[model samples]
Target: MAPPATQFELAQPPNDAISALAFSPDSPSRLLASSWDKNVYLYDTLRNSEEGAHGTLLRTFEHRAPVLDVCFGRDGNEAFSAGMDWQVRRIDLESGEQTTLSKHAAPVRRVVYSKEHSLLISASWDSTLHVHDPTNPSLGPLAIPLPGKPHAIAASPSKLVVAMTSRLVHIYDLSALSASLSSHPDQQQQQPPQPWQQRESSLKFLTRAVAAMPSDAGYATSSIEGRVAVEWFDASAESQARKYAFKCHRTAQPQTDGGGSTATTDVVYPVNALAFHPVHGSTFASGGGDATVALWDAEAKRRMKVYQKFADSVAALAFSPDGRYLAVGVCPGFETGMEDYSGEGRTKIFVRELGENEALPKGKGK
Candidate 1:
């Protein structure tokens, strides 16, 4: 069969503006999305029924305020959501039960689960990060203050990284988190199951970087108008917390009206949402507002491929666990008639197959 015009347009949302999206870990063929309609929707991307071609909406959960972000835990069993309601809630896929947490000063922008499956970290316009142990909902004062309102969060089992509107990303050392959690006299023995030991850190390092980054390279962030960034810190760095400074758009500005602002051109488009390839070290994808999805060769600091036909800003993106597919959440018509949905537009999830030797058209004959 001839190669299709596009990889695949798996699903289109019910409403025009979709705000948040996630692909199920247990079953990648499934997806979850939230929208400006104050509702959460799930879809089976692989489903082919007479009802429609876009797939079916499995369930819809309503929020008092619009649902801005949605994320699935390690498996597909549960999902965490945060939105304009200033709240973070977890929904059990099987039970369909919802649990609400504290309110943020501003909109809760994102939610992610740490590796242990015990804690959920949320970033909000509130300028603070809340770490919650869903197992113990009554615990309080678990908030971590940030220099500015945070807009995104990424977490592994032992580390939590947050991206702020200030164009900085903060890394929290979770190796000692268990120690902190066990501080209470009555909870001394109830420590978290695993710690971020050097072994774990080394494993995370070997798995993430194609080549190991410098030990003193330090963990800082790169951003455009300080919108979002990715950072990595050496756990061995002194003043671990304060040593969280890495890099940025040394010279860039905010293009006010899309006149190809020097700032927009200078930024290489910092990664909006980051994810490791299910298979390769030093292989990752960065999705952002550039209307381009860039694949990176981390070790070589090289560009592998850029998918530029999205026609809008990209909000949520992911690599399938097996690394065979790339899913991007983008608003329709962003360049001409489409406005950025910020996870809130008529977004569609496009599944592109990897390893296409001819991803780009060749320059007529050699």
Candidate 2:
């Protein structure tokens, strides 16, 4: 297979680690990145470029604390972000106006927007999921309590999946959640709605990240042990039997002993991020502390390709809406404090152009 080609790297990258990278649903070329630098940057990937020029930076939204995650609004002209400040804020891309939506007692980890429902879901370390309606703020935000701190969250058009500590994955119906929140404006007083489905993760380690499949076949969850599991939503025996897990993001290093080189040690890197191709439901990408990004064909149960290693750990990954480009955010893993870097830290974002042959299945490739 031919090596993946990087289209361009951000010219002036973030000073700190990047927490999340998102491509606009409406505009595939528009990308947003949140970082520990306490800023969210908007980039236009379609901008005209001279040879070797980077993507154009549209604007930057400043935050009081490190921005952990960001998602674009329905129209693609606005974005919402949350992070270390324990607050969720919305920014207008055109006017540059900012509005505080909600606050949490603990740091917010993830925020995602549902274009179909016009709702914003924010998960925090406080063990609560806040559902916000941008169209009607007067209804206020509804906070749903969770069993434990959320490690990661992934959303589909109609469903929201929250992976919390203790190996719990809660799946909620978006329509049902919106209705329940509307009926009970006081989320504190009313009982939270039961999840559509609740399942214990099959992995032994803590869940690190999740990405919902485009076709809603199921969602893929990754663990810190360098393994990933594909779980189908259908609970039938046949479907359940198809669910499986595999190890990746690891390497075996041979020991330099004089004993004929038989000894080797296995090094495992945490799977930090996952993103599914918008067009091909069975294909997805996983990034890890090993500083490499790999593409997999989950249906075939094998890796299709692995991109070249980046400067630091691959913290986040995203595919454009049209599947024409893949965005990778390279930074140090947050498990270690950002300030504890032993060497000069490098944070970069790369956009790789994907041809039809690159994204399609092996048999379908031109």
lDDT of all predictions, in order shown?
0.57, 0.87
Residue 309 lDDT (model 1): 53
Over 160-266, each residue of candidate 2 has an lDDT whose tens digit, in order, gives 99999999999999998889877855677787778899999978899999999878789999999999999888889999999999999988987877867678888
Compare the candidates by TM-score and give the number of the best one. 2
- lDDT (10s digit) by residue, model 1, range 1-366: 435434677544646456666678767677787767787877776675575575566777777887888878767878889999889988887778888866777889877766454667787887877767666667642565677666555555456655554334455655554445435434434533232221112111111111111222322233333122223454545434332222221235566665654444355333344555645644656666566676655434445676665766565667665556667777643324434434334467677766643222232113
| Best lDDT among the predictions, by candidate number | 2
TM-score for each predicted model, relative to the true structure: 0.70, 0.94
| lDDT assessment of candidate 1 | 0.57
